[model samples]
Target chain A: MEAQKVLTPSKREQQKEARRNAIINAGYQEFALQGFTATKLDDVAVRAGIGKGTIYLYFDSKETLFQEVIRKNLFPIRDEAQSYAAEFKGTATEHLTSHFRRMYQALHQDRMPELVQLVMGEGLRFPEIADFFFREIISSNQELIQGIIKKGVEDGEFRESFNAEFTQILIAPAMVSALWRLQLEKQSPLDIEAYADAHIEFILRGLKA
Target chain B: MEAQKVLTPSKREQQKEARRNAIINAGYQEFALQGFTATKLDDVAVRAGIGKGTIYLYFDSKETLFQEVIRKNLFPIRDEAQSYAAEFKGTATEHLTSHFRRMYQALHQDRMPELVQLVMGEGLRFPEIADFFFREIISSNQELIQGIIKKGVEDGEFRESFNAEFTQILIAPAMVSALWRLQLEKQSPLDIEAYADAHIEFILRGLKA
Candidate 1:
């Protein structure tokens, strides 16, 4: 009887977790398609194949749902990057090259470019979303790159005068590539791999000790 | 009587030009403040201190007004950049440095960053605006930078192997800086001068033979 009772709750818990994920996946699609302001919770519920109230059970408001969508989709990538940087053992140049390649892969696989577009497009109008994005994504990414640069400088692989704070400059090419894909991909298709290689080569040459 | 007739039409033409400028200026403010979708022509008319019908006399729709806004404000800057590059007399390094400095000045003075934010934020939802922006602003800018890189390479100031087609990387920092100001300036204030200097130094070193 006790085993039955425990198994029943576990089954219920599994159902609940599944429902939550369905809502988030639907939210991602809706937000990506309709943007922040235009996305209706009812539409998300329909997409998720759930009742409208079910979304309320999982997420209190549209803002919270959007936050969860970002958290679910982006936080994993950020965490992976952090751990990857922590355990990386190689010359900084190799690390950066490999890291950028992986980043482009992520951009291709994950719809990260769309998310970046959503944030840049809607962020100023929604300051809270902007703040959350900066805190959750931008700052973490900046820290990861800055750590790599500092380590490179310490190991005498990079110029002593290289300002680690200017990691933005180092990463600007990737951001620009993403923006290009979103804005001008049809009119001007970019060779992203070649672009990535150029960026990596330019930075390494510029920062050589 | 003949002189009066000529003067009358010229005076009317001057008035028409003045009114057109007022409408464009008002459209800029509305678009910047409220974004593209949310901006209404009625509000723009009020802002321009004209009747609602008068805006229609000048602009067929909000899209047309927005296009005019972008063209009037951005085309001048692009034209000046073209002329500056054509007339520039110095090494490529000197020219780029001065060009970047002037670009920054325009970004600060002309509210160009806000316009960039507007286009990036709302461009995807409106494909026509995106297409217009790509044609009017982005292509010209890329061509200008490509021309400079080509000149530098030919003159032996830059590496012979440098790819002028990758001019996007050369100009990415400035775009990133503009975006950073729009998004994260409150959280992290960037010194624009130092940022521009870093960008120029990094690119020069990266491209130098």
Candidate 2:
């Protein structure tokens, strides 16, 4: 009793985080394989090696847990891409192309491509989660690219008239690449690296000062 | 009696076409609103004002009906865009821009934006429909753009390096616009016309000879 009571609050918090992460990992794997509609909360608990009741202690529902899985998996990748752009010492074209490449790479490497399908596939049915994702993921990422475009103009790499909304236009190729890879690639294979390079070339030439 | 007999064949053909069309339209409306998994054939039959058994006469299953709906609605628009590109008597930039504008316009006017959502959302689950779409709509559209790019290069308006596959990259912006308009517009309205113009400007500059 004395030894258990002596454990630090920070240690207790770490345990909670570990348990939470296990649940998230299991949720992502199950959801990716079976999709949003077919997945069950009980299976997630079994996969995580926890009691079904323990899942409720962490997540109110499967949707809530799925949201948490997206948050954990996608946020780090998004943040890393932002930091990579910030830290890069290159021309705006290089910076943007590298950022675009990294987004695709991370998406595939992390096996998060299914997440895109899930959002596009089921988001309409679940408006609140869709709204959360739009605000958090789509909006934030657009802003990041918009900022890069602004910087490119400031550095005299991109033309002054390049509308910031062109960021969306610029990244549109990457979007298609991700979606195609996840949902349509089996039928129509996209050579993603080549595609990305070509996209960068076109976009750079379009924006060149 | 002779007049009635003569009318029977053509009149029966017209009735068959009309019923097929009605089922397609009703399927589009219902599927667009409720999506594929949630939709029921009974509701579709009711909406089309046909016996539920009549639906089976025209379509083998709900999925087949949905596939026909996609084909009838999207194919005409795709063909019209192709025709528009062929008919345009202008510079390559003007031709491409006109085609781009027409795609967005038709997508919105026909209320087919939900189709993007449907394909993105359910395509993975239903591989047959996905494969059909990839082969027909996507591959054909990509080829149409490829032909335009080739013409642009031949006209000394665009560089020769713009490969046929570049067509996919070129059209990514329109894909994003359609998706954003359908899925995220309530939270963040996309001024689609302006977006299309900006896309045209950037793409034209990018492809300059």
Per-candidate TM-scores read 0.93, 0.89
lDDT of 2 by residue, A157-197 (tens): 88888778646787777766777887688987888778877
Candidate that would win on lDDT: 1
Listed per model in order, the count of residue pairs whose N, CA or C atoms clash below 3 Å is: 1, 1
Top TM-score hit: 1
Backbone clash pairs for candidate 1 read A121-B121
Point out where model 1 deviates above 4 Å.
A1-12, B1-13
Give one digit per residue, the lDDT tens place, for model 1 in A1-20. Answer: 88977767677788999999
TM-score of 2: 0.89
State in Å the error of residue B202, model 1.
Answer: 0.4
Query: Each model's fnat?
Result: 0.70, 0.74
Q: Write the per-residue lDDT of candidate 1 for residues B45-140, one digit (tens) a residue.
A: 899999989998888888888888988898899899889988999988788778878877777666677787778777656788788888887898
Model 2: residues >4 Å from true position, as ranges?
Answer: A1-19, A41-46, A49-54, A86-90, B8-17, B50-54, B86-88
The stretch of ten residues in a row with the least summed lDDT in candidate 2 chain A is A1-10
Candidates 1 onward: DockQ, in order? 0.69, 0.65
